[model samples]
Target: MTGEEFQNRLNAAFVFEGANYGRVHLIHGTQDAYSQEVLQFSGHLALSDAFKAVFLEAVELMNTYCRPRVKAPLSEHYPQFLARLANAFHTLCGAECAAIRGYPRPAFTTLRNVFDDVVLVSASLQKVTDFYKIEGIDPNGKFDPAAAKKARKDEEFKVRKLMTGSDSGLSADVTSELSKLNDLFDFEVHGGRLSLTDAMAFMKGTGPLHVLPKFVPQTFAVFMNRFTEVGWAVHRLVPAIQPPGVSMPKEWADRWTLVDESFEIAVRSLSNELGMKVGDAYAEFIKVKFPFNAGAVFPL
Candidate 1:
């Protein structure tokens, strides 16, 4: 092959068709930039669809509860806190979509972004820092790095400090989880030697490097688990914004219980019966495991 032909072939998008013949198909001369094939591969998975449904339901709950109509005469800080919480939920959904599409790196990075967004919401609630103050700008409406630098110097504004410090309002379990997740996601996002080597290892024996989406059930499972946890974290913020001793309305709370129970069953089913079809048996597992009647009213 000529030099141009060799380079063109080298840069083409290739996917391993099967392990039996070790065939790599170059479906197109250019890259599969949109990950169309990847999505197609993922679309057939029952567990993946369940994960998507769970996340969508969580986002729906957020839309239902985290709004002005839920509580009239909102507190002064409620708007800012809810805004940051909304951002976290938005990024959480983005991470879910990225993972569902078989883009693990983007999903990992965006999960870290979700954590940071949640931290900021917590910080605002704890009164460690004001959102507007940190976002302050010059009169011209342009960024002021100097002022930003000063804001960064504040001990209260440091992520680790805000998460772990005595004044941080987060519970011990939450503080520890956030701290651990931050490190884990940061390591993956930085794409260091270890991270790159690990990625390559995952693709080993699968022909050439996979530039397109891969249908890795294990990785998708992990994403679903993490998204479920993060969704709960987002939900917790709603009650945090309420008045002392105030909780979400019983109707909304009951609805959330249903979603949470369904999600847990889905995750457990995926774990116990990995590679099993998500059909009647899957629905049966949920019914059997949930300990509630389908026709019964929501449990008090």
Candidate 2:
């Protein structure tokens, strides 16, 4: 087929999906569909926006304070950690974009990447000695292939081992739960049978299968809540990883405080609206997510 023929055929397919299967095509109906979805769940939409703001603020704090001006011997590895943290924020931005555009399956898949990023960060922080070990450099600036291979292997952060090993400093119970969570993320990322079925726009009995994106309010709510929880856990670890002799600025600290307080309020309100019976809902969420350091707060 010619290029124009292929394009016309694809557009016809999209139009058919919208008319028959209730699918929102990317180029045509997604914006109107998303606008209606947001209106239908304004409270959850606001909470998603709040989570994005918090994640953005956390990235700004890292760019301003955690990123180094001059590379020092003691801070040589700061860039490695900061890069992963920044990447987590960027990936989350992508997830939010996908979600708001009515592509929740990919949004959920993007979140798995963010989860691994945070896990890697947590393991690095816990096993600081392994992370800070410096390698010998050649004075002649010659690279040794054997030494480089060894260095790469040594720097590997195996998620399963790190989360479950004794060196990770996590309790056995927490590690067990994390292992299950890891498996769940893997299933989502790998497109398991259940994941595929859930992505289809089905109702109580029977319906046409939708190939294009459609808004799933319950899935959106669940993913948004998980995103906020992960953001909260990662942000709380930032102060502990600040450069030696450097503290978080008072203005940024205060901003974090304001955001944290507001987030707690929003989380509690949302949880109650969603019929959660847990009292002190935000604190409970923190405890469940990061039981190893449930009491920790951001900005030190």
Best by TM-score: 2
| Model 2 residue pairs with clashes | none
Q: Which residue segments of model 1 deviate by more than 4 Å? A: 1-73, 133-145, 152-159, 165-179, 192-195, 198-207, 240-249, 257-300
Model 2 lDDT tens row, 1-300: 999998877777665544633353444576567756757767556655665665566566656865554243444456666667677767877877777777666677778777655655565555532333223234356778788557544554443354544454556654555555557567777855435677355643457666555666776766666566556655555544455555456666665555555556655665467665322444453444333321232211
How well is each residue in 249-296 modelled by candidate 1, as lDDT tens digits?
Answer: 565556555654555555445446675333223233223222232122
Please, what is the TM-score per model?
0.55, 0.63
Model 2 error, position 47 (Å): 4.8
Per-residue lDDT of 34 in model 1: 35
TM-score of 2: 0.63
Q: Positional deviation of 247 in candidate 1, in angstroms?
A: 7.4
Instruction: Give the Å shift of residue 265 in candidate 2.
Output: 6.6
lDDT of 2 at 168: 48
